[model samples]
Target: MKKTAQIFAGIRTPFYYYDMEILENTARQVKELAEKYRIDVHYATKANEDARIVSLLSEVGFGVDCVSGDEVKLALGCGVPVSKIMFAGVGKSDEEIFEAGIAGIGAINVESVQELYIVNAIAAKYGFVANVCVRVNPNIDAHTFRYVTSGLNTNKFGVSESEFPELVEMLAQCNNVKFRGLHFHIASQIKDIAKVTKTLCGVANRAVEWFAGHGFETEIINLGGGLGVNYENPYGDTFPDFEGWFKAIDENIVRKPGMTIHVEPGRALVAQCGDLITKVLFVKETEVKSFVVVDAGMNNLVRPAFYGAFHLIENLSAEERPSLPSNRVYDVVGPVCESSDTFGKGRQLPLTVRGDLMVVHSAGAYGQAMSMRYTLRPIAQVVYSDRINEAEKETPIL
Candidate 1:
């Protein structure tokens, strides 16, 4: 991990470089802190559920937070037991619900009463009772990426807090479903406490305010993952201030000791630990604009194109990294056809060449998970610790 710059200096490009040491430490940090509060934390599988990544998280005593039936199967396949997995999504198909029922997952964070009914029917058919938590749209803004924002009232995600009483009545009237708790998700990449605290505060109040009466009690409060990472400077604070982050929950949320406060943290735990590596395919110097076309494309990392995201670009070949007024300014583009397929535009970095290798810093989460085969691009591969990637880094052109 420490030699990321030096190691990528000689290796092939267009692949993601994962820092195992950093990732291991991240898992330890999360597990240890979560243990302190005795809170149940499930790492969101949607972040980056590589087999090794999931296994490392499991070793640290984290549960699984999956958004789809496929992710649930991946978690279980990777040895994260169904007993410790939770499924939450707005559009789970009947087939997925039936599969979850048969698997008897730990809990299904149901987005609506209709979903709860479907899950219940599937459970009844499977001769099992499904545990479920209703996802409530807290209507709080996370102030992060608009594309990732999922908890607004306008976002077709969760049930309204106003409908909680009716939902409780319906749940009590049902026989096959076991009510678990209330689930709340504000938005993603939230850095402001005002947003998180307010969302959590709303969740806390609604738990006791909306459903606790009339024999309906809320158990788990699954705050869906959306913790914004330090894209501005990932290494500045390798890990987020857990104390401050948790303090937001502490000062804002009023959780009873008995209630299992669950957090679904995805990027905050892994973003700093990984970097995407790509070799410079060509350095075109046009009078209009300089372009650095890399071997890796939007197919390998789509956050830039899909969400207008930015990943710090690093010139691995530069012995002495950039110190502005950096003479270099290039549009670090990929091989994808669409103009939006670029990663960082007009970014300042050390001068690079066609053979020079580059690094896309802070791509641990939502990086490889979002890769696609668009434009017939072959998927990118990843290499573990720098030491392990040396010999095998010479990947053939795809």
Candidate 2:
């Protein structure tokens, strides 16, 4: 294992620091494991939009899965092969579909039959035959955050079972469209093996029956990424047990001849190696509650504000304590004006003061990608372990 300090223990706070060495290890593990079963894996770019990160992933022999036009462009611009890109999203506009179709992408994962019509029309306008997948709402509860729960029957993400008859009729009308397969994405942060297995079995059974009636075999079965990580111990558990994750599903599901299995992983692959480093601006203590106000806020990382998500907050400056660092609990807040801007409430940590350094673990995947410029707190630099020495001169935190 690579030493954390040697790579990048601290050079800046209020900015995202990524351990490239850890990511390198993670990519190797994921690729080697998935290759064992001949599974085609696509790294979802929605989790982290950094072009350099995408480039590294491209170098590691992986495909790209995008949700928007810009994300598709980012993946391609960063060197992902056009033949290996798949587009996904529910609200894709005419322009977004137009752009992806024109890019000569591998396929577009169409969420609704309405989307199939739009994408096919766009491809027709471009004089091209586009490959696409119909996203099926299997209605399997992913047991994740409500906001991220998409496969539920009422969610607005995919085509419902009730719409199957129309979908089959529409597939017959696709003269300029190729219905390549079916896709399903349940939710995020799911770690239970049985839950995923049940979902896989359910999709396989449904699709097999759907195909028998319609004479359209599922060429690809895509189970979108919702794999969870150990945010509290990012370094120790950066890699997921793909053998269990993939094997469980593989054993449970029956694939058609020459069927391709695609997985679009974002957080599970990239979350652990990232940290949001910030400097304590003020340590305010009140009779009612204590707060650790920092330069970072919802603007820098919104997981806390958006989902009431939990991330491990640590005092890097207090590393040398004889025992564990200060165990006192306080609200780790930012400089935002909104009451929802706080990162965490009653967050216990080392006793801290102004200028002390704080490291918020697992800020990599959704952290920087979701940052905003609210209140104009200057955007922090993204430090990668591979180039930390270069960023140090330019992004040295006080």
Backbone Cα, N, C clashes tallied per candidate: 1, 5
Over 57-112, each residue of candidate 2 has an lDDT whose tens digit, in order, gives: 88999898899899988987898999889998999989988888887788898988
lDDT for each residue of candidate 1 in 101-153, tens digit (9 for 90 to 100): 67888888889878877787777777888888888887777776777788778
Against the hidden reference, what TM-scores do the models get? 0.93, 0.93
TM-score of predicted model 1?
0.93
Which residue runs of candidate 1 sit more than 4 Å off their true CA positions? 4-6, 9-12, 320-326, 386-398
Clashing pairs in 1: 14-278
Please report, as a residue range, the 10-residue window in candidate 2 with the lowest summed lDDT.
1-10
| Model 2 regions lying over 4 Å from their true place | 1-12, 320-325, 392-398
